[model samples]
Target chain A: MNCRVLLAQIEPTLGNLSANLEMHLAAIADARARGVQMVLFPELSLSGYFLRDQVAEAALPAGHAILSQLCERSRDVSIGAGFVERGEDGRLYNSYGFFEDGRLLEVHRKVHLVTYGMFDDARDFAPGDRFRCVQSRHGRFGVLICEDMWHVSAAYLHFISNVDALLVPSASPGRGVTQTEEPGLHSVRTWNRMQEALALLFQSWIVYVNRVGSEDGMIFSGGSRVVDPFGRVAAELALLDPGVVETTLSADATRRARVMTPLRRDEKPWLVQRELTRILGQLEE
Target chain B: MNRLDIQCELVEQLLVRFLRSEAGKFGFLRAVVGVSGGVDSAVTAALCARAYGPDNVLGVRLPYKTSSPASEADALAVVQQLGIRTRRIEISAMADGYLAPNEVADRIRRGNVMARARMIVLYDLSAEWRALVIGTSNKTEILLGYSTQFGDAACALNPLGDLYKHQIFQLARHLGLPASVIEKTPTADLFEGQTDEGELGFTYAQADALFERMIDQRCGEEQLVAEGFEREFVRRIAARVALNQYKRLPPVIAKLSERTVNHDFRYLRSWGH
Candidate 1:
């Protein structure tokens, strides 16, 4: 099966949902014209990143008119957008809401709330407790927001769930200039290696959609890409500029990589679970 | 491939985009850069010319009475190079108005007063020109507290704050600024013969090398000295960085109430933009 996906690498105005929502609508219209089956935006697409105290002000309920508009647009193209979700528990979560068929389907709260360096996600929003794969009409997609991809186990969980594609949306700040090599950020280079390694390891397509432009002197590196199961870049957007990349992702690539390696078929989750239980039991002593 | 050396073309790309995006956030499409014939100001003006078209940037030359004549010529050269609009406002009267009064005699005090007076002129002109004041102070002077606060340090947005003096020179060359400005010894030019290194008692080249390893790499004091840095040099420089911490930040607010401004209540300058 082939899925036509458009990665909307946008430059969102910080803490302005209305402007960002309008931007989303505009991109959605363009995606619809392009006949994209799935439109994936970067992390915090609706609500911009670095929303310190404004996180509460920007957090939207599921029924908000802004989100409702996105859901309505989903009738033509499935949309996955990041926002500050006001949970039913009255707590806020950094969420990626997947809208399909004119309704809300999944709200993947970012499980890994980065709090170090230039981030303070854990302080402003509640941490998500779990990662659940979304079986979309186009493909089996798993969402990892920014720093979630830093931890090995987050992608491993999606791998166990047998996801066809791991949709990683990011607002990664570009830093660390290279000296001897190319004229690009070290962070962007590292992200490339990470996606390739994960795609090869999991035998899953890695759709890394990152944002562009700057906020409070922090420039988000926009180098969105789709890595095939064979760890080759299928498609990539330009760096440091707002852009959109539309390409077809082949499911056969994943099937081919998995069949050639048979790592998934030979997996033993039960033995790993038993070993984890034993290690925990021993640690309690 | 030195650590202090940077990819000049890459740096220019980032800084130019940064100026455009950061200024656009607040609905500003114009910038006011004070060209002191120094490399920092020249590089800054070049970036603004690129970000907001040359017509949008107004390069103002705020020369005092005693400021070098070569300085004004250099500033004019930069304006011609960038093809931006220019204004020559002799600030000697404004500076002397305050200087001659109260019988100010100290050279450092006189220099500081001149710097602050130039700031006043630049800011007032910024309002009239409908532009943001572009800062010329680079990271080297900023970290060393070699600048007068609210003087040349005042800016609505700074693209040069993170770059060291060496990096600034690199960018100056890449931007193709006037060779006179690029190769001239770095100076605030507050007084007639005052050089930046003369006042700081250390060359920028030595300081930038130490700063990269000390601050960027976070080498401990022992490690700094172990890496061939003079022990005394490390202590004095580290102390200056510690002491000048206040100069780098906004005034501290007392947290008397919950969610006080800057203390607890936090919002970026681009809060809604």
Candidate 2:
């Protein structure tokens, strides 16, 4: 099915949740005007990235009063965004929350904890250990956090399941684009290519939203995209701009792509039935 | 050209010239950055190697008890591929026997120990080897007071200081860095698994673009708002960079005398009689 997806590549400020919420509202309104059915936003769109020790305190429960406020503001369209989630175990996570038809639907916590340079989530936020699908009124949707997309196992499981669309909220940082006159020797465009490749490899329609702003010293170039099943970018929001990119995904277009690719057939059998076993292993040790 | 594109081109061009000029001065003679197996250090290492030759460069991997095995492996990998000399120093005893950990705040004290320890190793190696200490700090980190004053921030010369985090990735690829090194999330490796972005609360691309438009281009917060940016983000970033300007400068002191070191009578050539 072709559904119009709005990718809101916003530049949210660190630690200012209120203003970030307002920007979401405005972007939602703008998406509604563009007749978009669903909107995707960058990870931690409300609180921003690089929260340091503050993430533990700044995070709210998935269904907290603040999330309810965001749900109300995004009443007109299905909005998916990343936020800090305080789970039942009292552990905080990098989570993506979904709101549609004026209610909360699902929240997906990031599974992979990126502990390399310049990232400190392993210190503050606990890594998630689960993956599942949310049955939205629009369609069966799969939600994953930024680093979760990097793990091919997660993508395999999500695609093999009933999810028709995958939504990813990211704060992927990279260098700015290179100029022709400049030697261009200092350019690294692999991060952009990585996202695109992941979308295609999954063979699921992707709505990747990224934040644009400088936090601490990391720069998140906002090159949000809406990719088709074939991995082609249907629409894109330019990097480093506080703007929205919208594209209509009709049910017909989705059907056409699915029929042409039939990726689900190849992907279904590969779904491992080892999830329970893994959880059991974790519990045992 | 679109004004934005033009500005991007201009900034990119300036970065190239700066890299070239820096390399011309330090490449063959001496160029080095401490490779902590982090993205920033890795990028700096690659740039230094590219500016000069790999044979002329050096990689120092200083590990403590808490340092990950992956860091040593990765650091060695970069050195081997780049064909640079490698030095592995275990500073656990030095830290444990020399410093009093109980009296210091956990994070700051750990940072101090790590920075000073790493600096001592790098400079000592630099002195014995006749190489310069290449700095790995990027502009966004420097602006936010996110780095140690004389620790990781101190360098004989730095080619990556003016560039932001996002730009380092670009340069990394252009310099043909190993995919593993280029793709890894940036981290200081101070802890078991510390990443630069997660602690900072924002990504490098956004920060670099924002810095470029606001600080480098001198665009006002109002302009960013009109451009559809979140006002709070603009204000907060601008404010943080402004507040942290001290981290980017030499130490400041009140001037009561006529011939203060930096402010007045600052003639380095005339100092020698």
Candidate 3:
């Protein structure tokens, strides 16, 4: 189950589908040359983030020609990337696609659309309805968009669903200063802390990829990284610079972490389900 | 260096890189900045010099008839230290061409005319020199709406828009700006003996400290008062910030369709690239 993954920290051209697709193809080729099994891109990698009405024009169907070309190009390496998807219901969704072996494996619509300061995703996109872990040739992994991993429940659902690794694609803007007086301390540190907690608690590997470069005055910090089950940073890219970070993950580490921690062994899904049902019933009454 | 100094250095590097990338993105290898001998413009000129190289940066000094001679000397001092190319343009005739016949006596009205006149000279020179016009407005002035619209506020890009006035002084000192420019009383210098603090009725240091507490720290009025800020001062500053909110944003348009310009029809600057 050991595999090498490359995190592509790219500066996407907003609403330029062809240009973004070309960047993705180049990164995929680079990953393949490095013998990487999988490459992960940041959120909305195809159309860039912070697109208001341009999201409609940038929306692609699951079988769109560009996606087909990406899937075709993914024959040598698996590609995990995000894009705006136009559903059959005519609603647009912030979506992630997993492509492998010249085929589209899975598409996960982002569940939580951020609507806070500087974000208007809720106004632009329809929220995803469900969450599920997808199986890959390397291992079983779960996908989470930027704000999804912020909530403890999202990671808990993935952990209970038995995912070996959690992949998070984000477009978080860099803010605040680091303890060492570096920029992007606030947003980058928060992301790292959340990923580490989830990895250590779930005894699973975590891969977090964020975009870089400024778009319309908003700077996206590109501190893409991978955390092992021991909450250790395996590999990381530079902050605010577009680059690639490739790291090899050991499957045995997860097994050893689970054995040592034993946090997941004493789980009780039935009790949790019963409690949730009771709480919902009480709230309804 | 202390924490602020360390942060200032990091920001300086970031801004230098940002200016270079932004200028190159817009197909310009050079920059044009209007240096007023004030801290804001001096720091901006220094940054442009660092970003585009002193040879590529054009520091323009546009002085009206009543502008202080000392202001021009300080601006020249900056140009000399940075070793950048400079142009001295007298704006008095241009501003008076329209203002004289109308007999405009209002100080505010005349000040705006001079500001707009300076912008006109900078923009025309920008076209001739093939350089982007970098802005000199600081966060304190922008927040207080102390700038005249479409005048000194106009720019192709602004590196100093995010830094407050006091922070601008810190950066100016760090960039080796002339002590005279950094230590002088802040002024738009629109008229003889005119100062920014005299016009605004509040010192920039006071406004900056209050802004850091109220806006950045999210402190309430009561909290601010508890922290030793005068109640009346906090109230007045809060009112000014609220009233001038429109100046900080793009012009508003009524939404009539599914997608409107700037409101819904948004795209990044890299779209054309």
lDDT of 1 at B174: 84
Mark the 10 consecutive residues where model 1 chain A has the least summed lDDT: A176-185
Interface RMSD in angstroms for candidate 3: 3.6
lDDT of 1 by residue, A14-92 (tens): 9888899999999999999999899999999988999999999999987999889998999989999999999999999
Tens digit of per-residue lDDT, candidate 3, span B6-62? 256767766776787667766898989999888898999999998899999999998
Best by TM-score: 1
Full candidate order by DockQ, most accurate first: 1, 3, 2
* TM-score ranking from best candidate downward: 1, 3, 2
DockQ list for all candidates: 0.73, 0.02, 0.44
The model with the greatest lDDT is 1
Query: Interface-residue RMSD per candidate?
Result: 1.2, 16.8, 3.6
Hey, what RMSD does candidate 2 come out at?
Answer: 21.2
Candidate 3 Cα outliers beyond 4 Å, as residue runs: A177-184, B1-6, B252-260, B267-271
Tens digits of per-residue lDDT, candidate 3, A168-232, equal 99998876531254444577778888989889888889999999766766778788999999999
Answer with 1 or 2, whichever has the higher DockQ. Answer: 1
